[model samples]
Target: MPRLRYIEESEKTPQARAMIESAHKTGAPDPRVVSIMTRSEIGSAWVELWNKVLYEGVLPHKLKEMCRIQISVAHQCGYCSTVRSNVAKAEGLTEAMIEDLFRYETSPHFTPREKAALRYANLFKQGEQAIDKDEVYRDLAKHFTDEEIIELGQLCAQTDGVGKFVKSLNVISWEEACEINPKLTEARAEAAE
Candidate 1:
C-alpha cells in the first residue's frame, strides 16, 4: 500500500476524479500517484503539466516513455518502473525495448536519436554535473533541435525528481520490486555504474 492515503473516489473533486481516470486510461502517470496527488491543491495543475509534457510535446511519446522508464529502473521505483504508457505502446514501444533500455548505448533496439535521449536521461538522474557538460549538449544537438532538447530535459527532470519522491512515499519499495523481478535489482546496479 502507498504511504499516503489516496483521496477517496467519491470525495474527489470533479477535476481530480477526471484526471485520475485519465491517468488510469493512459497509464503513464499511474492512477495511484494521481490519486495521492489529488489530495493536494496543486494536483490538477501538476497533472496538466505532466500530460502536456509527456503527451503533447514535439518529442515523440515513445522517446519520452523510454527516458521515463530508464529513470524509474535506475532509481528502482517499482511503481514508476512498472507503469507503461498506452500511447507509447501504440507508437510501437514494446516491453523488449524497455528491457533493453539500460544497454541503450549499444542496443540494436534503439536508434542513434533514442540512444542520445536515453543517455541524457541517465546522466540527468545521476546528477547535474553529469548532464551539464558541453559534450552532452553537443551530442544532443546532433539528434535534437534546441526546442526538442528543452522538452526532453523537462521529461527527464520531472521523471527523475518525482520518481524519487514516489519511492519515498512507499508506494512500492525497491526490495518489493526485486522480489517481483530479480533482474530489476541487477539492472539498477548496472545503471549506477
Candidate 2:
C-alpha cells in the first residue's frame, strides 16, 4: 500500500472522476495511478499536463515515450521503466524495441534516429546539455517539426520529474509493478525468459 491515503474513486471530484473515466476507456487506467493522482489535486494536475494538455501539444507520443524510456533507464527508475514499458506496448512499440531500450547501442531494434534521440535524452540527463543541443535538434528536424522539439523536451522533463518522485517514494522497482496488476507481473516475467 502507498504510504498515504489516496483519493478513493468514491470520493473523486466530478472533474477528476470524468478524467478517470476517460483515461480508463483509452488506456486501461490503473485505479492506483488515479487514486494516487487524486490524493493530491497537484498530482492530478501534473498528470493532466501530460495526458491532456502537453503530450500531443509538444511531441509525437511515440517519440515522447521513447525519450521517457531512455530517461527511466538513465535514472535507474524501475517504476518509470515499467510504467513506460507498458505505455510503449500500448503504443505498438515491439517487445524487442522495449528490451532494446536497455541495450540500444548493441540492438538493431533502435534506428539511427531513435538512438540519437535516446542518446540525447541520456546526455541531457548526464549534464552535457550544450554538447549535442543542436545535434539532436538537427536529427529530430529530419523527422519532426519545430513544435515537436519543444513538446519532446517537455515530455522528457515530465518523465524525469515523475522518475524523481517515484524514486524518492522508494517505488523504484516493482515486482509486478508492486502488484498494481497481477497479470502485468506474469506477462513481464514470461517475456523475460
What would the TM-scores of all predictions be? 0.95, 0.72
- How well does model 2 score by local distance difference test? 0.60
lDDT of 1 by residue, 127-164 (tens): 99998899999999999999999999999988988788
Off by over 4 Å in 1: none
- Clash list (residue pairs), candidate 1: none
Q: Write the per-residue lDDT of candidate 2 for residues 1-193, one digit (tens) a residue.
A: 4544557767888877876775565442234465567667787786677675333564546656767766765665545655643444666777457656656666787777677677666666665454356776777788667776666666667767766776555433555353653444433343233
RMSD of each: 1.2, 5.3
The global C-alpha lDDT for each of the candidates, from Candidate 1 onward, is: 0.89, 0.60
Candidate 1 accuracy as lDDT: 0.89
Minimum summed lDDT over a 10-residue window in model 1 is located at 177-186
lDDT, residue 132, candidate 1? 80
**What is the Cα-based TM-score of model 1?**
0.95
